[model samples]
Target: MQKLPLTLLLATVATTSAQAEGWYGSAKLNSARQNLSSALLTSPRVNERVDAPDNTKTFTPAFAVGYAFMEGWRLEGEYTMPSSSTFKSYWAPFNANVNSLDTHSQRLMLNGYKDIPLNDWLSFYGMAGVGLARIDSDGYQTNETRRFAGNRRHNFAYSVGLGLDAKVSEKVTLGVGYRYVSMGDVETGYNTFANRITARDEQLKGKLKEQNLFLEARVAF
Candidate 1:
């Protein structure tokens, strides 16, 4: 009976070693940065263009699932809904209360990863992917808040990431990574003055670039 148990244990270990392919699920806690482009506006007194300060950094979370199809390659799909960030224009000539926005985004991506093994328990990986993103915003002007009727746009986005992973158990790994993402320009049209003033009624434009530093936990089966 003792010999039989030892034989089974060795056989199980051999099987696990031979089969390095499995399904994995992961969750990440992300620290994100937001960037915006310059804006140009015209007021009754003058016309001015200004680059506003970057939005506040926010903490967001993301989730993904993947399968290792070969020894060093995996494919994954992920979803993230980042928290809202605010932007306010700071051009001196115009009215101070006329141009503020609240912005947020949701994204879905299909990514491919290549892993390089440093040792039995450590690896480094790089990944690239394409995705769809929707950017939404609300505009606030002088005395009223306006919802831009056609403000939301769906963009084709891309991302790249590099990371280090360490195996902590038979079925678990821990990861730390940095990722960069670019979502194209978003435009919005507004009528906050309710037709009383049509001269300054125009569209708002901005481009988005983001970076994320994250810690992830992944489980494989």
Candidate 2:
């Protein structure tokens, strides 16, 4: 009778371990650099599309929970925290120079990952995700005389990444990765004052893209 109880206990432990191996939660910190495509400024008085200035960089965080449904394959839902960057650019003819324009973004994604075991303690992974991004910007002065308004929009976003993972322990893994993200387009609101005075109610539109380097940690539960 005692042996039977011991056998049941062993079976329960094995089952629990097996179940825990498939579920994991992770957190990551990313150093992301923003790349903006050419921006178009449209208004009744001026309609011009010109190249944007330079890249902006920020630090962001992400979190995910996943289940390994099959060997070497996993699916996860992740949330990227909001981050912001600022840019300054000059527009010719209109003499509209942006003193400071700030942009912000946040995203929610569903990702699938394929892992290949390189050794007993090392693995390589590639991942792709699709999601929605919320993009917004803050109003700023142009040429210290005219001020532009800000707007918010939601757009479809996607990302792809590849990385190497190190198994630190039975339940923990650490990784470093690079990802490319496309966040669709962002737009700014028209300045009402400009509209009334110079009939220059203009809005700026630009595509937002990013390259990110990240460090991540995952724990299996």
lDDT tens readout by residue for model 2, 20-96: 34889999999999977765666555444343657998999999999876457879999999988776665655555
Model 2 regions more than 4 Å off: 1-21, 44-51, 143-145, 195-197
Candidate with top TM-score is 2
What number of clashing residue pairs does each candidate have, in the order they appear? 0, 0
Please give the TM-score that candidate 1 achieves against the real structure: 0.81
lDDT (CA) for every model shown? 0.74, 0.78
By lDDT, the best candidate is 2
lDDT by residue for model 1 (42-122), tens: 344346655474566888899999998755788999998766776667555554545666678878889888887665677
Query: Model 1: which ten-residue window has the lowest total lDDT?
Result: 37-46
